[model samples]
Target: ALPDAIEEVSQADQDAFNQDGLGYLADKARTLDALPSDAWEPDLAAFDALIASLAIEGMPETGLMQGSWLWVGQRALGSDAPTPVLDPPAYEIAFGEGDVQVRADCKRADGTYAADGGMTGALSLTLNPTTMQICSEDSQADAFLTALSQVDRFAIAPGAHTMQLFLPDGSVMSFAQAE
Candidate 1:
């Protein structure tokens, strides 16, 4: 359950959102002498429908799910709270590939340039029916990549590839197939 303060604030915000009805009242008030009273109902109805459709329970939001998970000790009445243990997080992104191969490096949460999120190196994957291998680098691209061939192998479906690089630290760096 959400906190009481959060719930109250959300309710107040929703009430405010509904009360103004897409700022029609303010817009009309600005042009009070310009437009007649009959030009309001249809616009109001459209705004109401938009608000109703945006309800969380009524509709589900779709996107990549990402967040950090942490473990913290409960605060004691007479003792100082323990420091929070920050567990590493996995960020999943999907992109297109011409062949049955996709490769990406584990980046920081901001996804700027690549930093070692403790994967082997850059993550490379090839997906064919019942065969999947997550390699550190592209063997076909360079002789050096082929030399570092300590690949972690797995099985996956053939048509499209979704790669997950499981770090030694028990978190996953995954990329879902991009649409």
Candidate 2:
């Protein structure tokens, strides 16, 4: 039956069917009324090799942190209060070779903040913002600056599109890659 089925299939159709097709056939063979012992033993060496070739050796080290990230929101600080984000005043952070910079646009004015540190390891960040130009209302800009100063570590999501900075005061600032 298998030989007759193979003979009926065209060469192009056979070529189009890859290992996944073989896997499907093998699975179907298991549920059939009768089949040869070798029917379900499709060679999986190619699939294993493909998987092995795509495996990453270790956690991503530096590529994800080298871009501008826009502030989405902050983690809820307490049980009663929810995290609030002021969308009009965009807050952003940019990572350079070994330095970092920050920008926040408050309704009244905008500020530029800079620091002189970067990722110390795969999951660690150390930023000591040396200069801050406080041109906006002190409350929002001051809170954002304080949070930036306290960020000692960071975590990037698997796809590297989203990130979170962990602050010493148990707050997490969430960010997404700037478009």
Candidate 3:
């Protein structure tokens, strides 16, 4: 039997992602409204309440995905923990308009992608079947290809420096923007 399609967030998972990874938010360095004179203070109590209300309403967000990325390794689907790649630079993916270029170990493949995240950031991608050409004995080409095939959705980090392709079974393949 398969596990539940929608797993409720455990307390552990919820706590892990909350208030963490606030690097960008921390750097925001913004105060709602400030008065030039030290003696003057803007009464933002009502404004604070309004801002909290709007946040509860939720805003749709989108991130740019077209670019080159070097495979960084894998992580749990919804987690930010990093797992180092054996030889990070060997694998990479370059996404263009409706198409993707993949470099898996010693093999290369061209394919297509569809991202209709609309407001939710959903994505779909497909790649040509892996080639049969022999790779180095230690190469993980086949495994990488399999992971790519299972990617159903993705998320890009705040700085657009990292991307994670999440598989249905909870394996997330991570990639970093290529220089």
Candidate 4:
């Protein structure tokens, strides 16, 4: 005869199951089953060449940062540099149609901008004055605006997922692209 109740599970066993281990395996099997038999063997060399071209397309272009981005924080050069920390809903900057939309904590602002020379490996950014509203005492509105004002150039990392704004004094403001 079988026991009516099962034994309790341990923490390690639960961890080993992952968040949805069985579900993950099931999905993978389903995907394989959905594939046509002809696709079982692929031209790996052709796929590799196509992927290489896609990488080139991702390289920086003028105003490549045009889109919404989430601020990851700022950092200055050298040994005393402070580590970047993310505060949820920190700040978001949007660039498009020759304009920049800023969300600085509790405050909001908008302005026009020009991006030139990115093709030459040097992207020059110029921003005009923006309309600003005062924010709470604990807000970093002032600092955020100040940093934007000082940005003269910018660079986008590989995969075009991260952008770094550069100031004349060598300060860097990093941001991750928004979905």
Best-matching candidate per TM-score: 3
Model 2 Cα lDDT, one tens digit per residue, 83-159: 66576246777765455666665322223333222232123334454345555553355566567666755667766
Which stretches of candidate 4 lie above 4 Å from their native place?
1-66, 79-82, 85-88, 118-133
lDDT of 4 at 56: 50
lDDT of 1: 0.30
C-alpha lDDT values of all predictions: 0.30, 0.55, 0.66, 0.63
Clashing pairs in 4: none
Q: How many clashes in candidate 2?
A: 0
Please provide, for model 3 over 80-150, each residue's C-alpha lDDT reduced to its tens digit, 9 standing for 90 to 100.
77577787678888776678888888888989888744222446778986566788888877777788887
Question: Which is the better candidate, 2 or 3, if ranked by TM-score?
Answer: 3
Worst 10 residues of 4 by lDDT: 117-126
User: Candidate 2, residue 42: CA error in Å?
Assistant: 37
| Top candidate (lDDT) | 3
The candidate 1 region of ten consecutive residues with least summed lDDT is: 62-71
Question: Could you give me the TM-score of model 4 versus the true structure?
Answer: 0.56
If scored against the real structure, what TM-score would every candidate get? 0.17, 0.48, 0.60, 0.56
Give candidate 1's total backbone clashes: 0
